[model samples]
Target: MTRDIRQAAAKANSPEYMSLWAGQGLRLANDQPAASTVKQTIDEASIFVQRFLTMRNS
Candidate 1:
């Protein structure tokens, strides 16, 4: 809704950010754990981006 959130959504949709998120998945797949803070931030970012897209579409 806010400009900051919309900006984050755009950044999250970028290829570099997508690759970074995907890398986290690969780390998990390999049984490597990301730092707690990194994991939490990424998880929250993912949720925000998903919800942002949903709201945008509606």
Candidate 2:
């Protein structure tokens, strides 16, 4: 098992190889425009941080 893992990791190091990985959130946003997705994520993150910080202080 470790040998197989090492082989996979070695293949990933090749410059010609590339991985197009995306999280569930990114996959869900695929239909939206890129700019819109970015803005929405940032806005949501800002709101979450604000709420979390306020809660921590209370």
Candidate 3:
């Protein structure tokens, strides 16, 4: 049970995984205008940082 819980938490926290997910999101959002591109990049980067911090904390 403890191992299962840990696995769940790790899945929730993995930065590399999250970055891929966010990158996909950015790609989808790319159809929007240029002004939105900066926001999307920043949002994706923020997700990357959050994932990094989560991994670091673990």
Report every candidate's CA lDDT.
0.69, 0.74, 0.71
List TM-score per model, in order: 0.42, 0.55, 0.45
Question: Candidate 3 on 1-58: residue-level lDDT in tens?
Answer: 3666656667889543232344455655436788788887899999999999999999
- By summed lDDT, the worst window of 10 consecutive residues in model 1 runs over 14-23
Candidate 1 lDDT tens digits, 14-33: 44323234545655554446
Better of 2 and 3 by lDDT: 2
RMSD of 1: 16.1
- Model 2, span 9-42: residue lDDT tens: 6688743334445667765555779899799989
- TM-score, model 3 to reference: 0.45
Q: Which has the better lDDT: candidate 1, or candidate 3?
A: 3
User: For each predicted model, how many residue pairs clash, with residues at least 3 apart or on different chains?
Assistant: 0, 0, 0
Please list the residue runs of candidate 2 whose C-alpha ends up more than 4 Å from where it truly belongs after superposition.
1-17, 23-27
Model 1: which residue pairs collide? none
- Residue 26, candidate 1: C-alpha displacement in angstroms: 31
Off by over 4 Å in 3: 1-31
**Which structure is stronger by TM-score: 2 or 3?**
2
